[model samples]
Target chain A: MKKVMSVLLIGLLSACASDTTKPTATAEDRSAAPAAAASAAVTSAVTNPNLNPILTDPKNILSKRSVYFDYDSYVVKNEYRSLVQAHAQYLRDNAGARVMLQGNADERGSREYNLALGQKRADSVRSAMTLSGAKESQIEAVSLGEEKPRATGHDEASWAENRRTDIRYQGE
Target chain B: MLMRSHQSSRHTLTLAFLLWLTSMPLQAALDIEIFGGGATQISIAITPFATEEKLKQSITAIVAADLQRTGLFRLVDSSGPALRDPRQIVYPDWKNRGADALLIGSTVMLPDGRVEIGFHLMDVAKQVQLFDHTITVPADRLRAVAHQIADIIYERLTGDVGVFSSRIAYVMKQGNKYALQVADADGFNAQSIIEYGEPIISPAWSPDGTQIAYVSFENKKPVVYVQTLATRARKAVANFKGSNSAPAWSPDGKKLAVVLSLQGGSQIFLINADGSGLQRLSQSSGIDTEPNFSPDGQSIIFTSDRGGSPQIYRMLVAGVASGTAERLTFEGSYNVSPHHSRDGKSFTFVHRNGARFNVAVQDLATRQVQLLTDSRFDESPSPAPNDRMILYATEVKGRGILAVVSSDGKTRQELSMQAGDIREPAWGPLPRVR
Candidate 1:
């Protein structure tokens, strides 16, 4: 009976300790590791070409179709080197083609701040396209802060897709 | 006995630690359980001299009404003290009547048709005088004199400066047309500033209080525009291709911060006052919006969801080039729309918890969060230049209404028009002349 009572007391004490323990697991440190691994896997499966929305879509023949930017950055994530090259090549192929890059903030921030973030996103896309092949006179950029949400729900899934710039060709 | 002594020692040590903990200043953390009790039971006694009954009755009632409208004090019936002189205030009589505060005054008519008014604040509990002052004004201006005195007494008790004289600017949308209206802080004195047949969003005031920057959808796409308050001159700041919105002015009036999304994503950028010398600030993949400069002009605090959720982030002015950023808010899943206090001591923002949205303020020194508004959906809390009052948009009667509340969240008063719905109010800075 004494041995059983001691074991029960130990079990209760351990349960209490676990309940009062401060969290050792944080969202970033835990979720970030898995997200990075998944992203790496995705990149490996799909090499550079398929991810280039500009090169594959012939609709982008005017160099005004797609703008590229850097990773984890809206300042024109730079890996779109060839993708921007294709757009610049298109702009060279068809001169006098004008496009506007609309930057959009995901529904993850205050509308005012998101508006500014979207502007920077658009500016980055314009810079990359201009550097690759598009002319400064042919491209315009603007930002729409989280006011116009592509996805209505407030979740990570929706937010990830909303932080982007749209390329609109000014069909004359 | 020895075991008992050991236990007693342990108890003493624990008691000592508790005392030390209590002595330390509680970090500004607040667990606010708001009481929705609509009104206060403050009763003020006004006893006037016999000769000035007509002027006293009208003036005192106006003063009492103003105090009552604030929902901070109550004016009690004091007809029993009729004909009492201001000099002969019986503090005990007011104390016996269960009065928290008493206002007694007398007016002396001058030969030149002017009047001299003397007022006193009697502390019923302490059975002594709290404050007293005398003013000389024309007899016709007696009501204004009474309001001035009420303003004085209100300021003394409440540490916050009064906003009884300030104004609010809001956008009222009716069908396809939108109008910019400015009115007294009390929703009176409504006057239209501009009326357009299209959508107008995000009205921002210049530091000098002479110009307003807004986004107008006149050309079928969002474009940034600025209008002068005096000449009504309108100029397009930027008409970029994709989106041009969310205009903010720096404190020095030299630069304007706007969101331009010509790139593939939206980011914060700075442009010269004339819309030149544009520079990009944030490079995060997540959407960053609502950029506001700290009063000191050293850093910018903006809303960013780069970390997978919307939160307030701080970056130095140099961060535009250096690319260094730090997260400022960690509590609650949602903390957005940050407006810094004029003194730089605190900032006001809206924090969302589940389905409920609240207007909250954060103390920079203590890192304490205080919710000022309690409603279903509250947004766009703009602080007065005094940093004592915040005007925000809230839902009422199934429509959006503009409401103002004190910074401490103790006194809340709704500012609305009986004619139409009003939302997205931006409290202008203190008048430069005033």
Candidate 2:
């Protein structure tokens, strides 16, 4: 009788240890699953293998806030694709998060024309966000035209800085 | 500043009396200062007018100032003797003084409280009388008479219609107060047409010089309003959702082409003068605004970014059924705010070249573009009624001021005020003489 009782006690202790160790192993995978899923859904292209820090670290790719364009062009360049894709993944991981994409232009054209150009640029960024996994309602795109220039200058370097799409988080 | 205030008070008193007598608002006379002139200006001499009784204003001084302000004529020293008659023979002396033309005049007060004025224009080289005219008017019409004489002499000499008798409407902002003011073409006799605390922009004169269309930002958003000069009666022509701005009058004064953002993006639309018929003139996913009607009223020119960059495009007024627009400007990546010349032969617009914005005109036939200004921020180019000069807004010492450039780009002048920033000057049509 004493041997049978000791056997039952050992069996129950092993079951408790297995249950505790299982959750500890799965916690890391749970934290990483959303970002992995988001990347997989966006494109079949190779992505950064170490995305955990990129998604959470303030000094990582997610911290980059602006996408710039060439003169009179709205096409997003290849250099900014990974940066935008990381942001898209972040937004998809956190559904409650909202962002505002403000498009700006250099003071080279008419006020109304600049306003339209800025709108197109913001829209282009919004399109990329939605295609990556973000919800349409989570983003708002607006144009500031040449009215709100980041660089108050009349040169190519200043203009290149002024013409940009800025991503802003909620309440910012 | 003190002198200007004193002059303005005196001008107000004069205008009040003139309004009571003629039942019309006499334009506030402006004082003009010439900045630059052509390389070879016509040299002319005008002797002091002989008057029986001491006149209030000097006829010779008024005429000389008017001609001098045009930058087309240089007033030679007429300090010799007052010649009331052209018969005073001193032809060799005047010719040797580098005088291409000479003018002499006289003013006589009649017994019935009227005045008789006579003037003569003569060719100094030919020693021939070019014009001799006499006019009788009320005692108060002396300034008007002088301007008419100046116009006649200017036309007879330069073969171009004078703008001395015309007026200009502009918005003057002092602190938070804005005044849509009309002054003489020389920037004198400024009288406020409307006063508001909000901003006023895009002042456009009707074809008949009796009305003005402008954008007012009173209700937190821009609204287009047309106000008659005589009655001061105003009606909001466009108060749609978003913004309504940049009003341009049709040639017949029957319609207005305006910019509205009713459907999310700025686009040009045409509204009847009475504010009834609303029709969209431009349809583009991109922004299309700043529409000016052609002289013939058969077509409209506006700035659009449909082709990825801002460019001037022309379309028929027959509506969107007339698909597509013919691009008019391709010299630069940015061209906007086009104003058609009175003759429809060319249009002036703001062009961007290497980050500098300047006024440029393109001839429709020759496809040649001429840069009219070299300023860094010149905009809102409005041609004079005679198309002899282009009035535009520019920044001087960080203050907005109006400037005029001759159509040939030879002469330039700045019309600045003692206080406040003035912008969006629309040169009105010539006043019809009764």
Candidate 3:
């Protein structure tokens, strides 16, 4: 229990350091292998509930991976700042970590336009992560456009849910 | 997952693919609904050619359907006076029935297991034969033969080339799978060229009508592929990073203009037929996509947001030309998918007015815009090879279906499938002489 508590404290301190300064995140992430192991531990917690605590706890900010946007708008909302920050901090702590950002849009306008809009959304998320100290090499942004939708409804309720940028870790 | 496991680079309706089709067949027949027509519809009466019923297919019926769908020809009553031959037709009797023109023919099977069809088009009031021809083909080519006869009649009466023999390509999404289909101009004998567990869109037929360039998302990202209709061999024409889509073929069929995002925001790039010689055509930091070449092969029209909203723009694509792209659309803030007519005098595109997106055409000389449809959502407006009608995709009752409109916007029709969203239509060029 003491060791676990020490690890949790270290994780919290590094997440804060990374969110504040890129150089500070690089400095603390000197142990890159162990930090990557920490990400794996967090992910494994999905299947084994007690393996990892903070992100997979179902109440943590890092638990959410989707950044929803307005219709025809790729601007990341104010409500998703901390959620993006948490993921950026996690990436900053793990030097070897890689992520693929899939951007999508609602099926309302021209598909080619939606594709470009979705790409803008992905690029926007990528900018947010890079600004918060995530390495540019560790992230890739791509647009799925309106090709794949989470909900098949033709109403606004479903359209709002589909206009989003999804964050996916490497090997997912 | 199993679908990709069987995914070969080339898929012909060949023997192997035919065997595989047993497990998955072409979805179902498409249903077409036609309404409205030209200002003055031509009244014509067609009688069954002698011994036409003995043959396997109804040649006259197919020809009549082909002509009727154009909204230019109205089928009058050819039922009176037992008119099986041109000599047997009484001009006064036909004139009383309101037929300006009459068509009669005969079909005979040869000893070599082939069929010969001879047709005649006569002016009922003038009492003279305007056209006559005989065409020979194997028994299986009856439908195409009928289309050819209809073309001859259409040309004689309308003073324009007929597109009855032309084909069309579109995408059909059924359940979780999507198919790229090719069918006759009347939506018959649909053949699934490719099927996968992903979305397919923007099917552009080659100018020669032998190949199709489309965007497929089977690789988890959109990649443009050019597939030969005959050999079914395909190659990824544009696989750049980000998204590669909205492929349009040059009129000469030597190059394709595709939208790519490798450098940043979506931009237009030109590539050769075999996917080589990549050249960035449009230099814009904002979104520029959906490139279509002029019929003369000198200029290209595309959709761009460089000037605030999405509007159509034209630029010289030939050698040593102006370095500026002139804006063409000013009325609508959003106008896209510009397809040049066969004559290059006008182009068809989708226009968004308030909440509804409709099909519209703009004359190049007059800069006049003509609204062609009132559908809530209309897309992918492609003009026929004859420059007479426009085929497009529109949503009806929340289901996507194919629709057609005459160049004058006087005639309208819709083609819907039993299941699946049929959309992304590209009117095929006239059948080549091959």
Candidate 4:
């Protein structure tokens, strides 16, 4: 776990700048598939297992799926930058990988408004990932709103957990 | 702290529950627990109709419960003399029993099996008849006929149009399955219109009460669909590249104002009822959703964050393409889900300050804001057709349930199912003059 953290820190420091840029799916960028680089990453994923794994290891940042938000906010915070960048790099490394970003809100405000807020949260994460090197077409953003809650309590701690965008790869 | 006032009779309560289940595919019935009443309730007594015991349902029992649910009418002892002929009755007897008004009816079973109800409403002080009516309906329509009687009494006494005969649509989620349901305003005779595995929200009844438009995530994305209530036929009215939700029917019922993210931000758009002629209505930089058409159909009030924080804004229908927007709410930094009242005088919405979100109503002319509920979490403030009540969803004991707060914020009632969460309540318009 310590070794993985040190390696992720170096990767974060190098790619942090691009992670904050606005994601523009340009025509040239659409054609640039990075197929050769992906094949190499896939080979190393089997032999080395650092760049990509099945995501069961708790030490791997990719294992953390949720990006929580403050009340009535959709901005991706600075704390989750490394976590998002790790998954973005994983998506960039694996071409066939498809991801779904399900946004959610606490049980506050109108359901429709919360749904839109949830979508914005999911879109925020999608923008961060696509800008960090993930393909724009690889991610699908949707909102669960407050329908599904991680914790059903009405306290702040439960509401904090519910206001999130979950990153679920295809299948799992 | 809200008090739970159960019905006066337990038998009628069971039948109401049975009626709700008999209409649907046998699910849990939403038990209504009334809380607060009007400042001065109208004391009225509904006596058992002569020969009503011969029928399957007691007309007086159904009528009594409907009146009691409003919290505006107090049901007095009705075991007094009940007669179809009012000339033989003594009005002073009811006055001595602490009753200001009296309702008496008699049931006539026709040979062909239809039932005819002849009822009379009498004022104890005036000693004169207020309303007299004779209604004939099929045997299966006993509940409907009972509700109609309640409506007539409500309108005559309160001067406000009665909503007892109308229905309400909401989303009920049980375990993994979610169902869009429609029920009578009193929370009886519920029937599921659409059932799916995914989440459903924002049910807007068409102006005519014949159809409903809602957002369903069955396709894994929010898409607006309009379903006809009669034949159960439906079509996707808005399925754009991105999220399509927050459907509001125009007063004319020809077009729908919806929120879409087609241009990268949630903006208001107009589409025909049959899902044609899509036109963008409101153009805003920040998020703009939850559009509600005014009663006159001239403008719309929607929730927008263009002014830095979420607030309610009103814009003309013609001005949205390229015109100015008017902000309606200024009391709070967070306000959304604005719903116009039937008279178009005021709008009800969710107002949040700090962490407390409450249902609030604001006058369109005066702009005076009044928070209706002090509950922790409240949403979806849908006013009754007569503007006498506002139905919304709030959290009680960490469970999602529907609440009805009086327009003045005095009376409140909680409607909850035996299990599962009930949310997104949209009150239907008055049942067409029938």
Candidate 5:
């Protein structure tokens, strides 16, 4: 009778311990699972590892706030592709996050033309992000033209800073 | 100790004298503030009054002081030429002295308690009276008569409406705050309208010149507010989720075009003067902002990047309702901050070429562009009501000053504050009632 009782107590203790350890193991797995799944998704999308460069840090984010053009050019550059891809991956992983992209320009020309140029910059970023798998619902874009500037100085350095799109997280 | 004290006192006195001399205009020393520039100089010769000797000490100096401050004419000194009556300007002698035009005026108090003033603008070269007028005003308005005379001379010479009688509304920054100050066009007699401890920007006067629309960052975010100048009454026009700025009044003063981001992205939104009847004008996957209504009110000229680069676009007011925009400018890589002249003959905007930025005027009918300013930082070129002059803000020696230049880029004048910076000066429309 004593042996049966001891056996029952050991079984109950072991069962409780196993149940507590299971959640800790699953929690660890849950956190690591998304990142692993994300890498796999990226890997599958592009077999070329070089093309699938992981944009891990904000330093790799586009240092330039704006990309200027010669008059009315709207073509995206080969250099900004990796930066755009990183932003796209951030949007895809977060799912429900919405961003407001504001485009701006240096003070020049008519207000209407600057507004159009600013719109093009924002649209370029939006299109690139969309092509990279960012949902359409996650991005809202606007042009400030020559009105709002990141730098107030009317020099080339300031103009370059003024002529780009700013990505802002809208709400939590 | 006494010698050292005397030395220090002398040094202080000398410093003060030098400071006053350097800070004041040359006319201020001559008891007149002549407009500073080289042009067809307009000279005025006032003969010493033979009668009313007691008032001569006061009236003569006051009249001369008033004329000089107009920045329109130079008072012929007692030593520069032979003494003659302003009425009887010897054209040959005046012309030889480099005076292209002349002004002669005198003041007399009538028996009926009124001051009667007579003034004449003589074309020294043509040897003809360009204009002569006699105004009988109350004694209190004697100085105003002097300004009227200055205005007459200014108009006759420049062929453009004189802004000497106009007023200026500016934002005076103090510490981290700003005040809306309304003063004479020469930056005097300024009084604060609203003394809020926040950054106030973009003060624009209504068409009637009674109210001002500006962006005040009172609530941590910039919001458009309209304040009546006469009453100090203010109302918030719009507060969008993001930047709500560049409040431009339509020519008729019935509507305001503003940039509102409440609709997900910043777009041009039209609202009534009293902040009602809000309507969205344009929508793009890109930014659409800085909307200026055409003088005809049939369309709106705004800056957008719908075609992949910031460019000017014109959308008919009715067509914006139908959803269409036509491209306007293609010459430059950058063009922004467009304002139409009162006559609708031309439009002035900031244009960037290579590394330089300047205020350029484009004749709307011909599409011909003329550079109005050569400065790299020339932006916000607001045309005066006469369409003959433009007032723009530019950085001079790292300080911003409001500069006025003839529409043809002939005459240029820089108006700077004693401290701080002056920017975004939208010259108010001519007074409606006055």
Candidate 6:
């Protein structure tokens, strides 16, 4: 029991350190640093249990509606953890409030492949949400593929913006 | 716990390596944008066919257009003189006018309310008759007869079967209405197979040329439907719980490979012609879609991101458990929408170079990849039945249009519509025996 607590303390300290220095890091470093922070966020949310206030607050991380992903990847970054955690907590708090996760891919591959990749991305978010306390029944995941892109240019900047998952409330 | 961490680290290293490789500038390969045919084009002169004053169609004009559109023949100006009768042909005059071949024909009204068309293909260089034929048909079939004559001349010169008699199907979007249209290879006689407010895409023609399988969004979601050309009747073959798209017909026309999201993600599934025998062919943790059958029907090729980036892979058609899929493309980070050549010797697909996507052909034997088009966004390449030309969709000034490139990458032609975007061109099979 003592060893387990020490290991957890070390992980929490490293995650906090990575979060502070993320802005100056390279893209690769930034991507790797997020996982620790996300796990820490997930752990804290499980302990607090009251997530409705943070989720509905406009200034809180849970209000962030989109989770951006790396090119050709569906893995959720650690930086988006607080946002995903807040939603997961809210779902656990409010049983009737349901949300849908729409996955999207950049316009870079075959349409069918994009659709599949989008679904994978959305499912990844759903997995994260479920792990953070959201019930599987409270979340619906779908893929709009490249058909519904947030940005329409054929450049990297647009593609980065387009590769994301948008969280929406029911009837919104 | 140690094993899991080791595996995760290895996966991250692999992704980092992929990013590094994709960032490297690809070697400058044979990337050429072909605008039109070259000077080696065969020159031929076609004189106006002798017809009654009331005749509504010009057979000679149709023949001239057909031959010219191939980018293989150059039509010498036929306005010099009217040589409707073969007896009045001065071979020396035509030869001096830079004509290697001369075609003269006459159309006569038969007593049985039919039209009799007679034509003779003369080799101007050899000063000898190459072909002579006569056909009697109703007036409505005159255009087809003209195409037949063009095919004969084309075969005599090039020794390859002509595709002038074949047709191409595509999706045309006009205003709020989207239509699945079939048109002559030259973009004439366009007939709408189906029309809807939602989009229609991924048109695939059956090997026998009697049916087309396509994806329609009529049900507020994507669904695969196969429609018989003659009856215009269609039934949804893949209307599962999730999206069903990217339908490809097998060579023998017994099965179709489609992408379904029923179980999760996108996976390749096979279904019978009548929507029976539903079996999953691909099992992947990542996206595995856009399945195409090999010409021999022994293997299937599809796009998958199991390796962290989209690439083309080929596996036996027996089943996924039968054997593992072998990756076929490594030169680029992105390659998809593969269509095997009719001869099974090569395949064409969309390859991305930097920000631009172009059509490329890969030889299975040599594994040589050749870029065929120099477009910013080229997709959905469908090789003609003869494998001599490839039709693909590309963007022109923000509008989608269909373009054809010869297999040699020496000639190109753009087929555009005035009203809306044209996309997802599928070259139909050869005409069936009547």
Please count the clashing residue pairs in each candidate, in the order shown.
48, 6, 0, 0, 39, 1
- DockQ values, each candidate: 0.10, 0.04, 0.12, 0.12, 0.04, 0.08
Q: Give the fraction of native contacts in model 2.
A: 0.08
Q: Put down candidate 6 lDDT per residue, B109-215, tens digits, no spaces.
A: 98887898888898998888899988999988876777788888989988988877788999888765677889877666677787765567799999999999988
Candidate 5 C-alpha lDDT tens digits along A1-172: 1122122223322222111111111122333543454344334332222222233234667333344443344555777677677777878987754555666767655433455466557777888889999987676555566656668885678777677776654321
lDDT of 1 by residue, B1-434 (tens): 00000011111222322232233233112111112223444545655433555452345544554454454564444655443344566667776655788877777778887888777777767757788887888876665566577666677655556555556778777654467776655455566666654456778888877888877654334667777777656666655445667788889978877765544455678877677677888777656667788887888887877787678888887735434678878888878888888888888888996777789999877889887766777888888866766888876766667876756676665655665657768887655542
C-alpha RMSD values across all candidates: 20.6, 19.2, 12.8, 10.9, 17.5, 17.3
- For model 1, what is the error of residue A29's alpha carbon versus the real structure, in angstroms, after optimal superposition? 59
Ordered from best to worst lDDT, the candidate numbers read 4, 3, 6, 2, 1, 5
For each candidate, give the interface RMSD after superposing the true interface residues on Cα. Answer: 25.2, 27.9, 16.3, 14.9, 23.7, 20.0
Estimated TM-score per prediction?
Answer: 0.63, 0.69, 0.82, 0.80, 0.64, 0.77
lDDT of 4 by residue, B154-237 (tens): 988888788889999988888776778898886667788877656889999999999999987764567788888887667878
Q: What is the DockQ of candidate 4?
A: 0.12
- Candidate 3 lDDT over B1-434, as tens digits, reads 00100111221222432232232222112222234553478988887777776777778766876776677876776653324467887789879977899998888899998998888899998999999888899998987898888898999999988998899999988887678899888766677887765688889999998999988776456778888888666777777656778899988899998888766778888889787788888888788888899988888998988898889999988543233699999996889878888899988988998988889999999999999888689988899998888988888677788877777776676765557888889999998772
Candidate 5 stretches greater than 4 Å from native: A1-172, B1-88, B98-100, B107-118, B125-130, B133-147, B156-160, B319-322
Q: Please give the lDDT score at residue A12 for candidate 1.
A: 23
Q: What TM-score would chain A of each candidate receive against the reference chain A?
A: 0.56, 0.66, 0.67, 0.68, 0.58, 0.67
lDDT of 1 by residue, A80-158 (tens): 5565566666666666545555567775324565566666677777777777777876666655555455665667666
How far in Å is the alpha carbon of B296 misplaced in model 3?
A: 2.2
Task: DockQ for candidate 3, please give it.
Answer: 0.12
- lDDT by residue (B1-434, candidate 5, tens digit) is 00000011111222322333233332233221233433543565443332323231223343444344333445563223322255455567766655666655565778987876665667777788788777888776644455555555667676766655567777766454456667655454466666554456677888888998887644333467887776656777765444567788888999888876555445787888777788888777666767777788877777766776666677877624334788777777777777878776677888787767788888877889888677767767887777766777777776656766667664455666667666667777765433
Distance from true location, Cα of B335 in model 1, Å: 2.3
Angstrom error at residue B370, model 1: 2.9
